[model samples]
Structures are given as C-alpha cells and as structure tokens.
Target: MGSATTHALAATSAALDAASGVDLDVATQLFTAARTLADSVQLRSALADGAAAPSARTAVINAVFAKEFAPSAVSLLNAAVEQRWSSDADLVAGIEELAVRAAVVADPSTDVEGELFWFSRIVADNPELELALGSRLGDASAKGTLVESLVDGKVSAATSLIISSIVRQPGERRVRAILTQALDIAARQRGRTVATVTTAHDLGASQIDRLRSALSARYRTDVSINVVIDAAVVGGLRVAIGDELIDASVSTRLADLRQRLAG
Candidate 1:
C-alpha cells in the first residue's frame, strides 16, 4: 500500500474505534456509500482529490449523503473524505474496509475470521465454485444471492453480510483473495494476527494450539492459525503471517539444495 492510503486507513480506523453504536446498519450504510462512490466517476474524483479544499469535499459528502445516512455514518464518511487517499480506488477500498470492521464490531461473539478462512478454502478447493462466484460475466447481485444462500444458517449474520457485500463489489479481485483479506481484517479487529500454515498433513488440535501459542509469543500479540493441508509440502510446514514467511517444507528444502548443487 502507498503511504497516503496507509495513513488514511489508520486515521479512519481510529475514527471507527472512537465511534459508538456501530452496528450492522452502520456497516450497511458504509457499504452503500462505497458502492455509490464506486459507480460515480465524478463523485469519486471529487472526494478523493487531495488538491480540493477539505470543506468542498465535506460539502459534497453532506449534500449527497446527509439525509439518507445516519448521523454516525455521515460523520464517518466526512472523516474518510478529509484524509488524503493514495488514489480514488483507495478511497473506495478504505470505505469498504471500514464497513468490514464495523461488521466485525457489530457481532462480537461471531468467529468471522475462522469462518472466512474456511469459506476461502472451500472456494479454493472447488474450481467450479470459484468460477461461479468470481466470474466477471455473471451478474454481481446474482452471485451475492448465491453466497447468501450458501452461507445462510451456517454462519453468523455479520459473516453472511460481509461475504455477500464483498461478492457484490469484488472489483478486480478474485473471490478467494478478497475473502482472505477480509479474514485478515477480521483478525486485526480482534487484536490478533492470522497465520496461514501449510503442511503435508492435517495438524492435530493440540499441535495447532501449541503453534498458535508459540506464534503469539513471538509476535507479541495473539495469533490465529489457519491450516491448509497441501500434500506438495511433503513434510515440515510453511507459515506466513503478514509479509513474513517461514518455510521449512521438504519441497522448498530440496529446491534450495538443487540450486546450490547446480551452482
């Protein structure tokens, strides 16, 4: 991410943290605002242009959204436009991310991060399903309805809303990628980091717990572990958290040895 977008997200996240009474309704309003901005080129440019006066942007926000949005949503939207976004696209993403965070906060008891990970895995493991959800030729609303039906009664209401909202506004992202990003955001909301661990075989529950404890100690915060069973790994494991990767898989080791021998 660019510095401008990073700072903008941080500022908006702070605003979200301070805001009270954030519920699913507020999240829905933010999602609506993101879609509205995304669909209008002029409005998106006006709100995201750093050269424009802050007051002018604020006026546009108020004029377009004042009566339709709740007071909290209006305040949050105003706060978002005040920040200098990396680009018009980032402005939209920032708002969408805020909506996801709001959804996470709204349902404190739900295991959204875990649910998103499993959902992403399901999509990854099924090519036809992934194509159905991520294909550009299909109608976005129809894809969203499919997601809602699939997740209904199986996941929390907030998780269902987040997943459906994302499919409807996927932009250029693949379905699984956006779901992974949402999972990371959900983990962050709970003061935890998500680590993806790939192993040749499924890990035992005790092993996962021990790995999570070790990672939390190393990272100095709580950690959530998502395990992927990849037979290609051969042995050992690969763990990725944020930008860091710890690869000890037999396949990676053999590749490195082969390269060394060739040199």
Candidate 2:
C-alpha cells in the first residue's frame, strides 16, 4: 500500500473507534456511500485529491452525503476524505474497508469471518451461481436479491449486507475474491488472523479448537480458522494465514516428490 492509502486507513480506523453506538445501519450507509463514490469520477477525484484543502473536501462530502448517511457514517466519511489518498480507487477501497470494520465493530460477537469464508466456498462450489454473480451483463439488483435469498436468515445481518453489496458491485474481480477480501478485513478489525484450512474431511470441534490454539500460539494473536473440506486434499491439511502457507497435505507432498523424481 502507498503511504497515502496507509495513512487514510489509519485515520478511518481511529474514526471508527471513536464513534459510539455504531451498528449494521452505519455499515450499510458507509457501503452505500462507497458505491456512490465509486460510480462518480468527479466525486472520487474531489475527495481523494491531496492538493485540495481538507476542509474543501469535507465540505464536498457534507454537501453530497450529509443527509443520506447517519451522523456517525457522515463523520467517518468526512474524516476519511480529510486524509490524503494514493488515488481515487484507493479512496473507494478505503471506504469499503471502513464499512467492513463498522460491521465488525457493531457485532463483535458474530463470526463474520467464518460466515464470509463459508459463503465464498458455497459460491465456489456452484459454478453457475458464481458465473451469475460475476457476470457483467447481469442485473445488479437481481444479483443482490439472489444473495439475500441465499444468506438472509442463515448469516448475520452484517454478513448479508457485505455479501449483497459486493455481489452488486464486484468491480473487476470475481465474487469469491471480493468475499475473501472482506473476510480478511473483518478479521483484521478484530485484531485476529484468519487461517484458511483445507482438509480431506470435516474436522471435529475438538480438532478445530486445538488447531486454533496452536495457530494462535504461533502467531501470538487470536486466530480464526475457516475450514474447507476437499477430498482431493487426501489427508492432512493445507493452512494459509495471510501470505504464509503451511502445506502438509498428502497431495502436495506427492506432487513435490513427483517433481523431484522427474528432475
């Protein structure tokens, strides 16, 4: 990340921490504001331009979004725009990150990271569903409705809002990728790390707890595990935490052996 983007995120994080009584409503409003900023080139430029006075940028934000968003959301956005951004795109991404953080802050007890990971896996398992969500020609509203129908009661309200918004506005990436990013952001908001673990079979509750404990000890922070059962893994497990991967799966070992033998 650029210095500007990093600074902007830091400022926004502070704003979120200071805001009281934040809830899913604040998150939804922030997400809506993000979409609006993303859709308008002029607005994004005005807000993200570092050369412009911070007061001027905040004024622009108030003029456009003051009435549309809750007081907390407006305050957060104003603080975000007051910081410098690397680019217009970064400004939009920063807003999205704040939205995800708002959701995490609202309901810290919910397992949002796990929900996002499971939802992404569900989309990955169904090619048609994935295509429908990622298709550029599809209607945005219809895609959002489909997401809501699938997850409304099954997941937390925050998770549903995050999924629906991403499906409606995935930009240039696949639905699964966007969901994964959201999951990571939510985990970070809680000062935890997310480990994506793939195994040949579903792990028992005791086994998962043990793994979580071990990973937490290794990383020195709380670890959230998102399990994906794949028979192709063929025993053992593949664990990914951030950019680090610990591959103990039988398939990976066999592939490495085969490569070494060929060489």
Candidate 3:
C-alpha cells in the first residue's frame, strides 16, 4: 500500500476513536446499512449516484424503513449523504471502519482498499509473488515469515500481516473481493458522490469531461462516475447520478418508436 492510503486509514482511525460521541443506536443502524449496501452494488449505486439528489438518499431510508426503522436513523442516513464522500468506495470503507471501530479494535494502518488493490496488483505483476504468498505452508510462522520478508518495510506492518493472515485463512475466500465490498459500505457511511453514465459505446474523452462538468454543476460538488457500455442502447446515452437517471438513449427512443407504431 502507498503511504497516502496508509495515512488516510490512519486519519480515519483517529476520527473513529474520536467518534465516541456518535449515538450508538444511530451509528449501529447506519453501520448496518453501510455493510448491507457494501454487499450490494445496486444499493451502493442508488445511494452514491450523483444524479440522485440529497432527498433521494432520505427517500431510500423512507422506502426501506417503512415501519421498523426509527425516524432518527433515517435522518442520520440523510445527513451522511448530505455530507458526501469523495468516491463510493471511499465512503463505504469509511462506514465499515466506523462500524468496526465501534465494535472492535482498530489499527489505523489497515487500509482495506489500498491493501487489497496492492495485493491484486502484486499478483498480476508477479507470478512468483502470488505463489509465494498463496503457498500453503502448514506452519503459520513460515507463511507469516514470507509475508513479512516480502512486504515488511514495503508496507506498514499492519497491512503486511493482514495480507499474510488473510492469505492463509482456512475456508476464507475472496479477501480482496470482501475488502472491495467493505469499501462500498464505507462509501455509504461517508456519503459518496457517484455518477453513472451508460452509452451504446464507451464515452470519448470529451464526453467524459462534459459529463463530469454537468454532473458537478448539477450536484454542486465533485462527482465520481461509473461508465458502462451497452450496445443495445444503439446511440445517445443514459446517465444515472445518485438516484436520478436521464434516459436519453437510443434504446429508449426505439422503445418509444415501437410504442408509437403500436399506437
């Protein structure tokens, strides 16, 4: 992991330590939402999309909490969305850590996203590194030693140990994927600004710039975008920012054309 990610995690950890004043019940509800959303891409996108207004986030709570959820919990969720996250993952991980910090011991050095991404990168970059790390040494000490030597002084001791431990965990699968999920959950807690644009084809650089600018103008804050290409769209674009979707796609047009023809 890079120094920057380490520092960010450390800072968040400190914030959590100091977050002692956040209402436990409220924190718990939000924390649960964060984790649940982390596990669901649809949920994360709905909450984080830039096209979605702040009210949309609250509406989600209202829709979700029909009766059982307290009003305060809903309010807290809205507040988190209003606060805004740099990116969906950034906020998701933030929430995860916040919840974890609430219930368990927190090591500031644990940058789940950073560590996971780096591990994946290492695996992609070097087959030897992957084998060495994934090697099934019956001895925990032996496995840990390999990790320490490979990653020590290279990454924080906390991050190195986490990778090593996770690698050797029995029946443990997809540590990186789980971390990615956690990152999404954390993003929810932090109130991430997410924008999604879908087109018949990948957007060009200019289109991306325009999209970003328009989204920022619409939200009055920086927006993060997730772009998807679908040939069915035919042409034009469909943009979803937050909860709002602007369906200006050729597929929508075709559908309308078909309806008109039927009429």
Candidate 4:
C-alpha cells in the first residue's frame, strides 16, 4: 500500500544491524513476510480470529512462518495469531517490534531512555505537522518530503522510515492504528498494562487523579484517560477497567425503565 513497504525491510534491517548482534537479513525477511501476509485479504478473512485456541491459530502461523521464519520468528508469529490479531498490520508490527527488543537486549549499551525521549519529543513538538501528514492532500513526493525533512537521521532508521512509509502509502489510514497497537504491545512487553477510560462529564482534576489512582491500584499500572463531555449522558460516570464496564449513569437506568414499560 505504501512505498514504504519496500523500504521498511531495508530500513529495519539496517537499524537492527546497527543495534548489534541482530541478523539484519533475517529481520528483513521477517518484516517482509509479515507485511505481505497483512496485505492479503483472502487469508485475513479465514483466520477466524479472537479466541483462546492457540492450536487453531498455530496452524495458520505454521502456514505463514513455518517455512520461512526462524524459530523465534515462528514463536512470535504463533503468539500473535493466538492472540487473534494475526491479520492486522499491528500484529506484523508487534513481530518487528520483538526484533527491536531483541536488538536492544543484544546491545545492553543502547540508550533506551534517550531513544524514547527523542521519539516522544519529536511527536510532541510537531502535533500540527503530524496531523497534516495524517491528513491527505495528495502528492506522494511531498509526503516523502515531510518524512525526509522531519524524520531522516533523527531517530532509529527503522522507526523513521516506518513512519514515512505509512504516511506515503495510498489510502492506508493505518499509521495511527498501527502506532497505537504497537505502543500497547510495547507496554505489554515491558510488563505494564494500559486502561483507557471515557467520561461523559468533565471529571474534576481531583476526580480524574483519584480515578487514575484507583485504576492503577486495581490493574497495577498507569491509565490513560480519553475524557469526553456528553451532556446526553444525563448523570453519573461510566468507568471502563480493561474489558469491563461499570455503567453508573442515570440515563442508562431511565432507558432501561422505558423499555420495560413498553414491553
């Protein structure tokens, strides 16, 4: 979809090459195969995703990675498929991500904090610019121009080129989705979990902090809030902790009552 697919492998291979002790050629092929699998619609449709059955998913993983991948790659692919995210680009991203982690592990001297800081700062410093890149006005070269001007030689070669490739890909509004999933996977890799919350009312600063604290203590990690003001909610707050929802809103109760009366 993006011109970056071709570049992604090269760039990732180079970066992992620099990361020390990683076999760039293996990483390159791994990235390529995962990307190709993601590009296929017919196979994506047959995956029967989102279940706990690792065996059923393992068959597909074997089909894709058994022939081409190394043992580590096969294991990573199987885990992703078992997680029922095999068909999405995010799953592929997670696999490449494992390689990145391995590279970091292989080189304990790598400045992880510095790298993350640079990426975070770059993203923060150019919110408007990133938004525009995410929005399309056409001109592939111009999009590539933004990547070259903003990202080149700044971060990991793989990271920068991957961002660029996602941007230049035609009609693939998947960068944000992939990044979000990649971040979640990154967090899980680091033994942390993220709980996202939405609110109908403007939670007071203290209330927000308390909620975050409660969620952190309950789930044992920091939480990110997606606060929204929905006047239509009528009353109370709805808290989502992981996959569970605590709906304590008056509006919901009234609607339930209305349905009962009609019945």
Off by over 4 Å in 3: 1-192
**Candidate order by decreasing TM-score:** 2, 1, 4, 3
Question: Candidate 2: which stretches are off by over 4 Å?
Answer: none
For candidate 3, give the lDDT: 0.57
Q: Whole-model Cα lDDT per candidate?
A: 0.93, 0.92, 0.57, 0.54
The alpha-carbon lDDT assigned to residue 135 of candidate 2 equals 99
Worst 10 residues of 2 by lDDT: 165-174
* Candidate 2 root-mean-square deviation in Å: 1.2
Best by lDDT: 1
Residue-by-residue lDDT tens digits, candidate 2, 139-217:
9889999999999789998899889987887889888899999999999999999999999999999999999999999
Model 1: lowest-lDDT 10 consecutive positions? 135-144
Worst 10 residues of 3 by lDDT: 100-109
The better-scoring model by lDDT among 2 and 3 is 2
Clashing pairs in 2: none
* lDDT score for residue 123 of model 2: 94
lDDT of 1 by residue, 18-97 (tens): 99889999998998899899889999999999999988998999999999988889889999999999899999999999
Instruction: Please provide TM-scores, in order, for all candidate models, with all chains considered together.
Output: 0.94, 0.97, 0.38, 0.43
